[model samples]
Target: MPKIGLIGFGKAGKAVANVILQHPDFTLDFVVRKGLKQEYYSVRDFIGVETDDPALIYSIEHIDIETFLDDHPVDFIIDFSSQESIFYYGESAARRHIKLISAISHYDEKTIEFLKHLSQKTVMFWSPNITLGVNFLILAGRILKKIAPWADVEIVEEHFKLKKGVSGTALKIAEILHLEDEQINSIRVGGIVGRHEVIFGFPYQTVRLIHESVSREAFGNGVLFVASHLTDKETGYYSFEDLLGPYFQEKENDGLC
Candidate 1:
C-alpha cells in the first residue's frame, strides 16, 4: 500500500479522507490541518469508524513543516487543505522525493509556476477540479465539438446558494470550448455540491454532456485514478487533463464493429 498524507480536514478533505480510510490499497499516514486542536487522533477514531488504520491528524499551528515531513515520511502528499499550502511544503516534499497531488481549486500564476519548478524534483499533478466524471466530461465535450463543429454550445454550472459567482470548472470548460463568458450560465440553489453541463444545439438534434458531483467522494475516485496512473510516471508538472487525455485515444477503422 502506498503511504499517503493529506493536507486538509475540511468538508471536502474529510470526505476524501473517509474514502482513503475505507479503501485497502492506500495507507493514510497523516492529515495536516491549520488550527487543528488534536495531534494524535487516528482518522478512525476521529471519524468514529471501526478500523485499525494508523492515520493521525496534525495541526500546522503546532508542528513545523520540515520536522513534520521528516518525522513522518510519505510516498505522496495530497493537498486539499489550502491554496497557499504548497508554498509551505513544496521544498520539503521535493527534497524527500515525494509525489504531490493537489486539488487546490484556485491558484495564481506564481503558485502554478512554483509547482512547475518543483516538478523537476519529483512527480506532481495540480488538478484544480480533481473529479474523474468532470474531467471525462471535459474530454467528451471536446470530442463532441470536434464531431459537430457547426453546433452551437453553452456551458451551465449550478452550485449551492453559499457558493458565489461562476465556478472555476465552468470557466475552464468555456475556455476549452472557446465560448464567451456570456455563453456560460450560473445557477446557485440549496446545497447542490456541483453540476456542470454542456448543451450542444444542432440544427436537427440536441446533445447534452453533464457531470453532477453529488458528494465529495467523487474526488476520492479521482484521487484513486490519478494515483494508480501516476505511481510510476517520471517527474513532471502535469495537469489533470494530461493524465486523462491520452486514454481518450481513437481507434482508426473504415467500418464499425
Candidate 2:
C-alpha cells in the first residue's frame, strides 16, 4: 500500500480521507492542518473514521508538517490546502523526493513559476480542478476553439454560497481557449456543488459545453485516480490534462458519437 500524507482539513480533504480509508491500496499516514484545539474531537472524528488507531489517525499541526514528514515519510503528499501551504511546503517535499499533488488554484504568475521550478526536483502535478469531467471539459473547450476560432467565447460558473471567488476551472478554460479578455460569471448560490459552462457564439450559431460537479466526492475520487497513476511517473511538472491522455485515447478508440 502506498503511504500518503494529506494536507488540509476542508471539505475536499475530508472527502479524500473518507475515500482513502476505504481503499486497500492506499494508507492515510498523516493529516496536516492549521491547529487542533484540545476540546476538539480526535483526528479520527475529524476525518470521519469510525475506528481509531493512534498511528492511523495522527494529525499534525501545519507548523510541524516538516517534522512529521521527517519521522514518518510518505510516498505521496496530496494537498487541498491554501496556496500559502503549497508555497511553504512544496520545496521541502521536492527536496525530500516526495511526489506532491496539488488541487489548489488562484495562483499568480510568480507562484506558478515557483511551482514549475520545484517540479524540476521532484514529481509535481498541479491542477486547478482535479475532477476528470472538468478536465474533459477543458479538452472539449480546446477542440471547440480550434473548430470555431472566430467565435466569441465566454464562461460562467456557479458554486455554493460559501465558495469564494471565481471557479478556477472556468479561468482555466478561458486560458485554454485564448479568451483572456472574456469575462467569467461566477455565481455563489445555495447548496451548489459546482457548474461551469462555456459558450461559443458566432454570427448564426452557438456551441455550448458544460460540466456539473454533483458532489465533493467526485473530486476525492479524481484525486485518488491521479495518485494511483503517479506511482510510476518520472519526476516532472504535470497538469491534470497531462494525466487524461489515456482516458481521452480510450474514448477516441471507442468512437465517440
Local distance difference test scores for all models = 0.87, 0.79
Candidate 2 lDDT over 1-257, as tens digits, reads 78888888777877777877767677777777765642234556655675432323344443555676798788899888788888767877899989989998678888888889988998899899988888888897887788778888888899999888777778888787777734688889999988998888888888888989898888888888899888899989988777876565646556853
lDDT of 1 by residue, 185-228 (tens): 99999999999999999888899999999999989878878888
Clashes of each: 0, 0
Q: What TM-score does candidate 2 get on C-alpha atoms?
A: 0.87
Best-fitting candidate, scored by TM-score: 1
Against the true structure, what is each candidate's TM-score? 0.93, 0.87
* Model 2: worst 10 consecutive residues (lDDT sum): 53-62
For residue 15, model 1's alpha carbon misses the true position, in angstroms, by 0.3
Question: Could you tell me which 10 consecutive residues in candidate 1 have the lowest summed lDDT?
Answer: 248-257
Clashing pairs in 1: none
Error of 2 at 22 (Å): 1.5
